[model samples]
Target chain A: MNRYGLKEKIELRINHATHHIEVDVRDTLLDALRDQLGLTGTKRGCDMGECGACTVLMDGKPINSCMLLAVDVMGRNIMTIEGLAQDELHPIQQAFVENGAVQCGFCTPGMILTAKAFLDHCSNPTDDDVRQAISGNLCRCTGYRKIVEAILDAASRLRRGKRHV
Target chain B: MKTFEYITPETIDEALELLGEGAQILAGGTDLLGEMKRGLATPKRLINLKGIQGLADIRSIPDGFLTIGSLATLSHLAEHPLVAQHYPLLIEALQRTASPQIRNIATVGGNLCQRPRCWYYRHSAFPCIRKHGEGCFAMGGQDRYHAIFGGHRCFIVHPSDLAPALMALDAEVRIAHADDSRIVPLTDFFVGPRDSLTQENILTRQEILTAIRIPVPPDNAYGTYLKVSERKATDFALASVAVSIAWLDTQVTHARVVLGGVAPVPWRVKQVEEMLIGDELSGKRIERACERAVDDATPLRHNRYKVALVKGLLRKALHAAHRSREKGEK
Candidate 1:
């Protein structure tokens, strides 16, 4: 039903699955992900782009979904917190849980996604590097100490997993 | 945000034809979407520029210039090898910009054309002069983050970190219209409150910024960007300095000192540059340059600290540039 109006039916390839959804041109990618697709894992914090709570992986790069229009990201690969785990918690998620990084659990999704994207490129990173990488994702809780520790822990864990493979 | 029609044009011709009153160009939507959400900007139509090809390329031209398309994301440019090798000062500024998430989505054109971060203008209730209102509320109201120089009727500072860095490098921008395009120096691209009360730049409604071109710096040229903020990460600069200097052994030959977060435009202090040129970057010379940097600064009630901040930043940046020369070559 694309009649060149305010609403258009667009296909979003989310989490290795494609879904056709009718969205308003004004709907942000965050709105479409949470309201339409029922992906509540991507929290809506400060609907503005200030807070990175609505961050997701747009083609494996962490971006604030709240700043993007749904129509603009039609065919891009969108990955939310829901897509991070298969049967068990992903290594990043496991490290977060093990290191007490999830205090209020509000900033965990965005923080993990940002950390995942950072660790993917940098197999070994210093504490300052991790801090600079995830500066966008703000966490009022945990004071970012445990979160930073968890990310470093996850990096080593991922490296061990790769060596085992 | 109100409901608006969105169209992605595939070519610059089609995009320019669609651009007019009541229409806004959507490059990355990092700034426009925020404005739309805050009701600071309301458009009847959005012309998304993502579909346009060849607008996001970063390449070195044959004319000894590095041309970057407008739609190129800030993160991509920051990570580009050419940018790192040629213009490290830009990378320094970009690393301190908004955040990783923002850098991933914010475009160079969008960053340059982004609206002011003044709280009074951002709020719809204020209706300040920049919003086509009667007077500026920050002139008397809370203006700790307001401009300290080149502010007349408006005190909002230009918020782009890239602008000052690019200005320090003697960059130019390409502006396209419906029929043809023209190149303008980056220094002339910005418009202060003395010229226009409602707009920040000289871009017309039908014009679009296509790309930015920066000349290849000389081998002896050294550049550095220093920003002072309340927080270490994810915060705008209170006062920033970008210094580009070329030296002949121990004496400065060419210099550009541009200050940000202190004026309606990227404030270039010719007095400081004049003091620096043909002189060795001695400790006493840096002190004199810092003094000249704040001679004409007209700070408001609450932004007097910015004058000091800019002075300190200029001192630090000049010292860094001086140290770079002592460490052999770039």
Candidate 2:
């Protein structure tokens, strides 16, 4: 039986960098990434899993970071928004820019990550599939039309092997 | 959130033994963590069950039932081939649930055991009867989302879309305790506020739900789940209905009608089921049966809309099931 108030040491591989961090047992992955590691690119919106701003890739699956405990995700590979751009923009990121899908940009990271996961599973998708894929990421600024178009454009680019990253 | 020790038990026996006093089981943490952030529950120890192996598998038992481990994610269940072909009602309800990200993380057991989303119960300021308070604030306050059936002292509704669907499918749950294990019908799982003001279900502190078993669908069985929520997604249902029927050509042989979002539990209307059985699912017959769906509903002041909403949902579900059965025959 574990005792309360014990700080646990957890290691996470974020953006290909492994870090050993100490956190309270109740600390969420969102808090560890934003507060401890200073990866503030993943925004925290609604924190209660209602909003998708805190989405990140865990083992290639997009999940809400705000709802996951850091200790629970020990030794897992997490890809945050900061990891998306190494030297150049990822294909999804470029599509968001060219299609003018980034307005205020709060929901952009989550939208892109969710689209990335969806596109990985479905190479050729329809308009309805794109809509269903990004239904979790809500954007009040772009009215979602541009975001949908950007994802479709990204899907075509990836299918054509135009952009690998 | 309050400070608590997180224990990831590797075995079910270890997890059950750890869940004694001042301990709560943590599956998805989609609901428990939020409740903790809101100062609702301050458990001293959190028994994280994610480390246990073989608890998340979905398998078909030979000559028995389809067993779904409690830890199976909602998204996985929604997309499983067997669920799509055999249990369309569950798929429909899961697709209409919270957004993709939440479904990816939220587990089936966690969804079934999650607490009510009543504003009074969630807010720390209200201190309603569900929170061991003196009275129910939603009785006279903002009660647009309260229950319309099986509510006496409290007026909160069950917030699970899968529960009503499971009830309609005649599912059962396997509960594990330290001493022994037992199987319970999904219909008898939930407890109302009139029965106990504190606990929502019959799960004791020592017990943990292990898996859910769904019997094979009968011949020519058709099922559908319809939900009417305030929003398209990520919102609790205003009212929902799950209809499952075994049709013999144009006549209904067996039927199960379970209602949600307007009752303390998944409300099973036996009268409606009886009315549907042995009768052809005609438009007038469905309309008349739906009219009686809310005959025992005692809607609160602000939720009288749910009475009409439930009827409409029932009618729509019945029609959808009929259409699905027709499409299957082709």
Candidate 3:
């Protein structure tokens, strides 16, 4: 049964299309991004906040949507794992797929989005920066060395493209 | 999580008016919501303070202070130009708190006003005194993260990196009551476990922290917050110190030594401050000050190592602050 006082289906633009879905303030953004929108790219490994499998960009910064309320994100530019690209994969996403960063595939989306946020702000981040950027996202499948490499690789590739243009 | 009545007021007075019965303020739901999720905190109403106007802006006052709205998230603290230039220790402390993801939504007021993160307090099974019960099991149970000072009855640390740094920076907290407003220094903001085992800070029920005001950094002042933790981020400091040191050339003009992970409040070392002042801030003098920092530490059975760890952290903080001072105002 729908919970009482669940506000009439709030209109949220996911990816490119707009959809009307009912949600309570208690329901998290991760719940709507996955359960309602059917965009399961954002994984839900640990419902508890420990694991960052459900990280997403809210207003262009990385946040654990599992810990954020969907109702609170009204008018904010909410970008998800699915919103990272449309016609093609995000360069970071492609790097993840190519560099074998996707082990169990549970943490790939959050990792790629987090990397995008980092590189978008810092074109050239040191090892400490890279470590700090993705400290929230955990991947038990493959050691973090590969994930770090892909992000650094993608960052350089993007910078080179900017120069050539 | 239990469903409660939700009210998002746009004005501070309106939000304060909605208080009387059973309502909890929700600001950047980093801590309050966590309590509700575990059924640890179940107010009859949930007051969303995010939509409240004028509570998220950051600006400076002509009186040599920077005012941070209660709703200003930790991310804002790290990125705001005034905070970055005037209070680097505050920024470093926020960086020491959770990761970038969590910091994006965690508010500084909530961080300072956060409830105890003790396993006993969070878990429902434990009848912890922190949860308004008879005794705190952490005294004999798993207490690796318990307190080292002011724990005559209960031994829980403050658990926020920003609090210690604010204390060192001589910040003041402003709160809005039902009819009036009052301000207090950062050190006086905390209430010890012995004082009120149920509350973390000294905010009244209807009162809400409207803003935190940090004074302008002292001339020749250099500040740094050093936290040692199990992980890079998203973990509380095992032993953290926010050290602010100022000097003309060799002799110390002022020094603020605030320690976290060692007590209920931001434990300041008076003797440590005494040992450093009027003396050259060389490595030798700094070492002597560091030893004096933990002279009064009386750790329990398990937390004995915290004394040495805190001392080491203080030395690192002094050197870091000294290094930052080398590049003075330009």
Best by TM-score: 1
* Model 2 accuracy (lDDT, Cα): 0.89
CAPRI tier for the interface of model 2: medium
In model 3, what is the error at residue B267, expressed in angstroms?
1.3
How high is the DockQ of candidate 3?
A: 0.43
Candidate 1 Cα errors over 4 Å, as ranges? A1-3
Candidates 1 and 3, the one with greater TM-score: 1
Q: Sorted on TM-score, highest at the top, how do the candidates line up?
A: 1, 2, 3
lDDT for each candidate structure: 0.91, 0.89, 0.82
| Per-residue accuracy of model 2 over A49-132 as CA lDDT, tens digit each | 888999999988899999999988877889998888778898889999999999999999999999989999998899999988
Error of 3 at A43 (Å): 1.9
- Tens digit per residue, CA lDDT, model 2, B2-120: 78877888889999989878999999889998999999989998998888898988988897688999999998899889898788889989998888988988999998899989898
Span of ten consecutive residues with least summed lDDT in model 1 chain A: A1-10
lDDT tens readout by residue for model 3, A46-112: 6556678888787688888787777666667777787887699877888877887777878888888
Which 10 consecutive residues of model 3 chain A have the lowest summed lDDT? A1-10
Ranking by lDDT: 1, 2, 3
